[model samples]
Target: MLNIADTLYRWCREARPFALATVIEVSGSAPLPPGTALAVDTDGNAVGSISGGCVEGAVYELCEQVLESDETPVRASFGYSDDDAFAVGLTCGGELTVLVQRIDPTDQPHLANTLEQASDGVPLSVAQVVDGPPRLVGRTLSVLGGGSAYDGTLGSRRTDHTVADRVRALLRAGRTARVEVGGDADTCPEKLTLLVHTQAPQPRMLIFGAVDFAAALSQAGHFLGYRVTVCDARPVFATAERFPHADEVVADWPHRYLESAEVDARTVICVLTHDAKFDIPLLRSALGLPVGYVGAMGSRRTHEHRLERLREAGVPAEHLARLRSPIGLDLGAHTAEETAISITAEIIAHTNRGTGLPLSRVPGPIHGRVPADEAPAPSELLAV
Candidate 1:
């Protein structure tokens, strides 16, 4: 399949007017993820972000030039340390680069064809920067048909095909790798460079039992950019009006609801139904799945009781050990809103293999939430 980034680049190219921004580098803590992008128009409208609210205004100016000149793609850097850098600065002190390319009719044929493939749900790579040194920095590869085929360049046909095959494996398995190429004659690192990175879709959060807390949890999940699904046996409680922000509200037994779900290591299942009638069946259903986070909300006493019932239901002792009973990190969360934050925080920590500590202590991919929807249609994008 065409990676989301390639599809986005195509969308900008097809739009009447647009500019593309990419985070080419990073240092220190950053609010925006590397490979983050924002497509802008002549009027300073934008669809994505490179930083948490910093550098956008300046990026817009570059975008305006792209729209006006319609010339070669512009490589612009936004750094806190650059004396000539624009006035905008990241609150967290991280630096990034944004390449703004103005799309024109000359960019039409190739871009339009690629966008049509993307709209048809076919993914492929396109040559992004030509005439530059044959370095990995300028070479971009696109994967189509869900990584079945690759287009564009990673220096040479040999390098592109080789890295494409390996990256394709990682994409299917939903993992990222840091590949080194062309150092030696057999595996030379001097002739060519290729570092294939893939940003899989955002993980899902399936929350059972649409109680008052469900609304709060849905909001929390939204903040974390999870495709939140709220399911309950009662249709009355599971209305979209109650949890309007939820990506989906299903009126089905929690156990049966997840049977049709595409659960994976990226998926999280949280059981908020403290009653046995719900918890027992729910736990039974989840035990067979490969979900990364399986948490149940209850007290220590309730957890013990539920464990006994789960054991009676034949859930393996090893599987039962995976449950995070008395769910959520210890944040002294008493209210529904605070409790929701704590639960979502635990899910984040679980997914990242992170300790439940302040994010400031960690030095890793901070903005990890991938936009699940294909890069928003130009109209769907927001102003910077």
Candidate 2:
């Protein structure tokens, strides 16, 4: 697929009139989510996708009309219907709305720049006019260089600053939200679409254990699209020969590694170092911070001992609850490979908070599974 942001930027640079179509809202079996966007130029060329080929052709026609029109950004709906007419409806019985508008070259320089940054794989949010203030209307604000700074405005400094700060935090965690500000504070109604881009790539998973189980778990984590780092304090065990699939195999103390490193909610710190000598101090350092997942592998007795040790060390009960003792779902896994699946499943369940049921059980449209041949090439994990 073409890079949507880059395509739009290049079109703008070439003085080409284009319309950006974004799936603003979706319900029931949507092929694309709310933030999914597509760009279509006057030449019938397009990038990105609003649907899985079901609605793209129809949306393209609308984009072409919007590009040729003088009307402002407009919201249009598309959904499945049983009227024996309207053959272009979604076959999956899903509904989606597309917000199409001509890119304001004069007002969208900053938006273009932010889109350019996004093209470089740095995620950003572009808040343009769906229909609001003229100056603030079609403005784009981007959070880059690790702070909230934008090239344009939303007319009001108060609203812009508040939204930027809140949006930046949400973007850091790869989320998109639509905010309606100025409830009682102002006269005009401002509708701002906050699309928080995952500026950086996927989150990193540092697995500080290179055992047989670690190999299986690391592989499973890789499938979940994490940059896996397998480290062990023992040099003999921490070798590329054993875990050739791991992204990083470091021979370092787990406690020292975590203590000096920068960590956030996106980073997962899994301490499979079954040894209390190694696990205790590592847990001590990890619990002190807001790391995403801190799971330690141990039995009921082992966790009991660890709990007492943590309490004696003055660690609060609330903080101790953050740790997932015994690690992984109760899958009754016996072998190392099976245990790894359970662990990875638990991680997914925690991340999505899924009910762990069959997809058929849910009332939604079934999407075609991505064939194995079309799947993304696996990154070489020999080195990070």
Local accuracy of candidate 1 as per-residue lDDT tens digits, 182-253? 444332234433333454555688999999888999988877667899999999899999998899999999
1-384 in candidate 2: lDDT tens per residue?
Answer: 113677777776777777878776789987877767888777878888888888888888888888888557767888888984357867788999877777756655666666667777654554434445543433455656433355566666656654565554455455555544443343224545444434554567888887888999888877776777888899999998888777778899998887777666557778787787888888888887876678889898999999888888788888898888888889889999999898877776565434344545533222211223332322421122
What's each prediction's clash count?
A: 13, 2
Clashes of 1: 13
Q: Given candidate 1, what's the lDDT at residue 231?
A: 95
Query: Would you give me the overall lDDT of model 1?
Result: 0.66
Q: Which 10-residue window in model 1 sums to the lowest lDDT?
A: 367-376
When summed lDDT is taken over every stretch of 10 residues in candidate 2, the lowest stretch is 363-372
RMSD of each: 13.8, 13.7
| Model 2 alpha-carbon drift over 4 Å, by segment | 1-3, 128-138, 186-199, 202-252, 255-384
Instruction: Estimate candidate 1's RMSD in Å.
Output: 13.8
Q: Would you estimate the TM-scores of all the predictions?
A: 0.50, 0.55
Angstrom error at residue 34, model 1: 12
